[model samples]
Target: MKLRLTAAALLFPLLCGAAAPQGAPGEKMRTEKVLRMFLSTSETGLDPAVASDNATLSLLENLFDPLLRYDYLARPAKLRPNTAAAMPEVSADGLSYTFRIRPGILFTPDPAFKGARREVTAQDYVYSIKRLYDPTLKSPWAYMFEGKIAGDETLRKRYGPDVPVAGLQALERYTLRIRLNAPDNNFLFYLATAATGVVAREVIEAYPGQAGNHPVGTGPFMLGDWKRSDRIVLLANPDSTAVFHATPGHNAEDRALAAALEGKRLPRVDRVEVKIAEEFQGRMLGFLNAEYDYLEQIPESMTDMVVRDGRLKPELAARGIVLSRFPVLQTYYMWMNMNDPVVGGYGKDKVALRRAISMAYNNAEDIALLKKGFAIKAESPLPPNVLGYDPSYRSPVPYDPALANALLDRHGYSRRDPDGFRRAPDGKALTLTMHSEATVGGRLRDELWRKCLNAIGLRVVFKSDKKTEIIKASRLGTVQMFESNWIADFPDGDNFYQLLYGPNAGRANYARFDLPAYNLRYEQARRLSDGPERQKLYFEMNQLIHAYNPWVPLTHVLSGDLRHPWLKNYKRHPVEFTAWRYLDVDVAERARSARGRGGNR
Candidate 1:
């Protein structure tokens, strides 16, 4: 069923909630309804250090709160205090960061924990960061903060076969100092992720094996119960001061950031419940049927239908749900494995081959066929929306098969065998394995990719696997060329720059391309305080990416979520924190007052 509906028809029904069988208004009126969420995978674990997948982190966000949170509408990537008393002090070089701990911040005890019920302290932060790097923990992300924190090597050496960890330290009771080997401006943003949220050290010690399952945080919601495949419940924190509301007189962005840091009430919602739904299509259908109060990962198909039909504005109004949209700094690219001989046939001439391969396909057509007008085609690794994207600069290659063929010929790939396959100068047929995740649009991509390669006399053997399988293959260096996308953990250029760094560099570098000059500038860009200097470094680094071409940049993925109209106070920030927080959710005030909280469970 083509979900192509006219906008006017969709909005017309929103004028009356009764017209739509199931709407946001009807769902919100129910007291104890569970919010059904669709996730592609069964959550691996809740440990922030090892939590790599987005799906699992999304659920964990409700159970944790970071020291500083992002104010999306604020300027220059606003950093508002959560557990901190004020903004952190960043050294002139951006290496040292000191924060004054907020007084009276308590860490609630988990039901599974045998620890004493008490408030969290700076010691917990010290222990938490150090624990992840402990050799005994075997945390994959222990290296993420490698050069940033002190004692990393000592900890690793001490715990080599026992329990090594080196990065974290506790200076004083309320004041903490963190020293980094190098400067990273976005380090504050990294601390904002739910996976990095602070936890009580006692909680971890009490139930060492069950820490992930039974979590605790200072967020407005407490982790009540989390059952794999059944349901996840977030009970309201009785002592939580989060009151989601805009300041009455504060209109300017700066004023709001100031107010947020002052510990003003933010969210209005009391509780949040998430029911796991694995099937993506089922989640979309159920959302349209209004079975959920709010659906975080909106079905892409339904978003397209609403956009084409123009029913979003009216449907949301009639149902009392709010619609919000923003651009996210996320890019989808194809990673070419240089380690494999057959796929890496171009070897030393990899840059020329990468440039040629980049020009073979029309990114615009790919978006039309795969993304359906939801995404923007990207020519550079850094999109124009990013801080230092150079608009005047352009890549050497263009979208032309003739040009692609010419580049190949220039690079000693001139021969085309009888079967019309490109061969190396040695008369060996060059073949590559193109790997892709089996998503909703995978089949379409398979057909489109085949056509693009055929035009350039290149034969591609496509392997489509589940998302997890594809990621594992890329990390293991088993795939030649594969599809991947990265959403910035924080709104900074380094997040993208570090991904293409040397082998086993950061979170997203699976292909492991190492360029010393590139890494040097990447480090400098993070440290340089001058705006112009940072811009220059970032621009130079990005241009080098085009010259090197380890990964072919494609397009920025457009993300959206569908919610019933009655689901109010729900909003999403652009970069950084994309998941919905329970604080913004406002139960129907009138309905709640009338029912007197005596309705359903």
Candidate 2:
């Protein structure tokens, strides 16, 4: 069912002028209040392998926890240990790794799961790893872990017809061993990804098609009720009690205090209710009116009001709303596919062309207008937060139309036609397709791209697609220059390196960039346990990619969520791991007390 109501109407349910008691009668009686949320855009499906979109992935991350999880500050926080207890474990030869696994952990299979809820074993991890590469399953995420492990080839050969990654073996029921053909210092951190959740053998064999929808996991929360196009309800796993409440060093005191108040039991909230509203304005208004006790990715329009009005800010303050700001490792950049045949071949001057275009962009103006003063201008693939990020690696290309024209002219793109578009000396027009998704910033960037290129006498055709279609077009090589964003999977530079390097899964190297030299450096960075050595390799690789300019890295996008007056402990990491485990958001009493707090006229 769809509800169409204005922001004012939506706020009424949440702002009914009294603090609803904790465990109040009626809908509020549930142990922890369900913090309803909005998506702002609808998801087509919940298939984790295929659902690469952020909105869907965000929901999935909340519902499922990997063997490793991130803490409040976005550091590696182990959930279920496998092989290694804590990271930075070096092997005897620096190639052979042996890590410890947390024993006695159980899997929360779907209640509908016909199989018994068995204890998650080392073999379960192996089977789950293999299941991703199962031929019949054919999950796209399978490629992410391919070729990184030992016996990958042997498993591929054995399960060649069905599963390809059956090689990650269970040395014993309690212990797991992953042998890498080469050493990857960053490999352990990479394994802790949302894409790398462990699967149970019985759960896999029991119900094939319904798994992603009704996935069984060892994470903090389990999938309870998922109504497509409506809402998804995730109930906290009572089993994660200890791990869920263990505070990171930073929040140790806060958790202690909250625990003291609640008899030392952890995980303040019982359930998280995610509502699907698919519009930014509606989500913001719902937060303002209190329909939502908490909200993520608060709209820019409301930010101004929160900043200007002390009353509104205090109302939010009284309710324990926290507006957190952090230096996130997210970059919004343009991917230039160098190998597309439709576009000119990856020319001898391709790097020069890409670099020139990168320089031509107006970073300051783009941030100001398009980002609504929320983002920082990015100039390299290495966002400022990444270890290799070079502030001086900033684009040498200033926003100079004259310089752009000169570069094109010097490259023999000087021939002018009746319409005044420049052509190569061979009369081939210097044209390219500039495509972006239909986002407010995307449209602004498209306009900026068109204006700048036209000044250089380059004929650029502007095109926009829905979010999903744009991603599809990029993979098919139909896009020449496309706008895309990436947040670090882990703190390692390898996440950025592998994505821009040729041959990684999803080949986020949208450019299909193939440079053996760069790949060699990236491989070296991955293998060594030496921090200095890895940092050096990353620096060299960053320099090479910057020079090549396969992607015109625009700017690091700075963004945050604006919570409602009553939403407390609402924090999110820029790394894309959203966990309310440590958050002490109390909607029932807080919202009720917030009545007469906002100076209601």
Candidate 3:
């Protein structure tokens, strides 16, 4: 098979003469299996410590190893040790954890290895955790480990250029230990995320400024070729120790999948090619013409055509096109910059203004107008299937423009300008500026926002830019407002609640909502395990968020996974990206069915 490359695609100068993996030698050689995928946006980078985008994390899953990982086909997902010899031993107080690293696991051949097969060690895991708090890295995920570890203060106050985390340690060459200052029920789930993926120390020094482009790890795949925003290819690591056994599942679907893949060697596919396309039309048409094997997150425009009543249309279904619809573990909301002068402050008048804005925006109407009635209005801060999600909890602020107008009039914002827009108490002009995507859909969404705010006598404006730039600005605390959507890093309510943690201002807390009362409650909830006590704390926090209106909680959107017939054993994980190693692709069947255009060169 000839590997084609776009003009932008360039061979990585860092690695050469690397051995490509062959899973089951003879029979696997008869058919070249390849999985083709697409991304709507370009990756931020491949450096796990610094990268936060979805595209980069998805690629990192196959290129690196975590101490643990979620079981393949488990419903209500279960954890299994990956690089760890077994599950960590937790102390009775839950403040201490110890793990044993698996021996003889070899990192992929790289120039930085100095002509030796480098084995992953306990210190490597320790180093990876430290990198998350490395001041130089400025990782967005630092919120997860902040103040939770026993000696985290040392990490934050470090003057050295290097990342030295005193809270994490290697008791032996194969034994790792972590001591927490407080108990965290979701700590294991954090260990399984790609942000905690292990990396070789020598490799980090070898690449210097280019570490994100050059990746080396003990996983099933190695980075083969990359073209920045154009394309990326992953070649299987021949020396990987990954193997497949029967997976325990909850339903008949799990039973069937387990039977089909009992003793198969991992990475049944030879290579995975991910293409980045900016336009949904080209991607949708490519899938329609069988140019790509599977399409994840099908846009609503494409969904309307292929789906009639939330299921795949019969004509496409007959062609063996499978549509897997699931509730995405995410929440989309407009985050108000609590630090901005116009909206900031804990005073009654400021809170009233923010609450009025929240009351005027109709979440259900937004879904109907933009999402084509596909998404569900979010009632709880946590999305579905997460621990501590309260299905019975309802928002205190409902959609009511009259009440919004009344609230504004009761406050100092009753004075109307010549244009009928309300003026600030000091008689200064008041305008809300929001950042949005520079596209047709973005314009339509902005127009609706304008209408909603205008009806309540609030002046609103929109700023358009690339999503990446907007995210950067938001992180820097410059953007006053933006349509922010958060996907669960793991299946837990802790992940959602941490978004407003006061100390996490520049990290996960984009709202920059720093209130001493809310911070104390979040800390209290983190220490207690899931129960009525924790539930009560979370409920109080939700009520405070509603009263303060730091965020106008919106919708939990829908996700549609579309795949062709030849891609077998495909199941979508709720909290993580696609697990490519366990998937099997039938090249001959795909070629014979169509023009051999899907997933293969």
Candidate 4:
């Protein structure tokens, strides 16, 4: 079946080159030196202080630079200095950190600069960190530094906007000193995240309350044009002097990738144009028609057509298309709102109900039938690549329909109504309402949910809506149960545990799970260094989550990206938000390939 384009896709003409005058064939085929891609949904905004979605975070990563970044090809990801001169100097107590800014870093030219060279200084970072604490902004990232920074809590309580934070200080023009309330080994990793990407104070002040739309920073790309939901354009910063430096790789594949990317000035493309294509079919058609250089996330429905026997299909391969796969630090799960009256309780019956539901849903079948074997059945919340993940840890909630039915029967749900659905203890019809998106894959998952729930003598009702609508409903606590995933902001177990932490309720904790013992263990684990002790704590937390069943851990997806062969040095970073700087596109080669493949649609 041919894909249908949405009205939004139809509105923007797919133009990769400038049109030459009437009879000039050679000039008509001129390449634009641009990288074209698609965003599944419109970006919420680009302000690092408030942007939380993947689309916004990805854009912000290129628009701003953090002090440190994750090594592109490392397996167990390592932190490296980006804007910092070197790794921070740590005090013996581990509570104090001192870093010096790399010289010659300048923000992209903007009105905020006021005709002066806006070089990045240590104070810029100090001010950027302070913005997270601004009460009016209410940055979602505030959780990262909440109690860790020594005096931040007090400053947050008393300050409104642009107040000086006591825990952070600019000791010199290039030097920054940060004092934390306690020792945290994972603190450096936190700084490496896109959430901490430094923004210039002048820019924030110039566009007060609108920095999300008007971003200015010292990164490889600057915002060229933005049309809200239609499109976004990023132009390579002419003033950027960032170069790709090689790192010693742990394996042969890493070494080869590093060698190919070494010493190249970023970003290789002159411009990046991102078009909004909300439908999977539209995105797939765009990629196949040579309108896009890369397909970032391949739709599950088209996975078989694109990839055959773990490789690109013959026709696509002959057209110089290549597939790259990487195991991401992400997990998709179904979360039950523990705050809901039907699902929330500490009693045996409540726990049994949740566990039975978890058991009834077959994650293995979902991976095989829906994901097409592109995912690993998740056993724990901490995915494979993270520090605290345990390979031997097995989920207590296995797929067992008989066990599920028996559990429900024992819990006083044995009575059946006229529809053959179970009745509650009070003789009311037992029905569950789940929120899902109105996408193809969503419909398939909802069907499976209905099948599984019906097998356990419960009727399931699905409320289908758009992706943003589902997210808004879930965040407002209006969703009783929902399917969601968390992509790690930093490669740490604490990042995952925060989703279940009571303090993060209504924010990251979509499940609204509030178990004091689990919360206590989560807090204890955060304070401990990464070692056997911390892994033990992680295991304990996993066991608690398994018993409580707030979220039935589903699958850890293996992300696949298909790109034109001319897109060189494209390696995936498991933790890093942006890696466009390391990528180079061969515009001539792409044009030649497109011509050989019978030209663009």
Which one is best on lDDT?
Answer: 3
- Local lDDT at 585 for model 2: 61
The per-residue C-alpha lDDT of model 2 at residue 487 equals 76
Against the hidden true structure, what lDDT does model 1 obtain?
A: 0.62
Candidate 2 lDDT over 298-350, as tens digits, reads 45444555544323366466665656555667888877877765332456455
The count of residue-pair clashes in candidate 2 stands at 13
Q: What TM value does model 4 have?
A: 0.91
RMSD of each: 9.1, 6.4, 4.2, 5.3
**Per-model TM against the reference:** 0.80, 0.81, 0.91, 0.91
Summarize candidate 3's per-residue lDDT along 1-601 as a digit string, tens digits.
Answer: 1222222212322122222344635442245467888777678768888877777888988888899888887778788888898899999988899999999888776678777778999988887888777787788877778788887788778723254555588999999999988788889998998888889888888988667766777777877677777788887766677777546655787788888877666776777888887566778887877767888777655567788876789989988899887788889888889889998888888999989988988887787767766688887678877878888899989999999999999989999989999999888999999999776567777988899999999999999987777878888999998887888888878889989989889877888999888999988898777789999999999998997989989888777878999888888888778768888888767886675434434
What TM-score does prediction 3 earn? Answer: 0.91
> Candidate 4's residue-wise lDDT over 238-353, tens digit each?
66767776575667866887787677777777678888787778889898887787886588777887888878889888877878787889999999988777777777877888
- Record all residue pairs in model 4 with backbone atoms less than 3 Å apart, i.e. clashing: none
Q: For residue 335, give model 4's deviation from the true position in Å.
A: 0.9
**RMSD value for candidate 3:** 4.2
Number of backbone collisions per candidate, in order? 23, 13, 0, 0
Candidate 2 global CA lDDT score: 0.61
Stretches of model 4 off by over 4 angstroms after superposition: 1-32, 161-164, 248-257
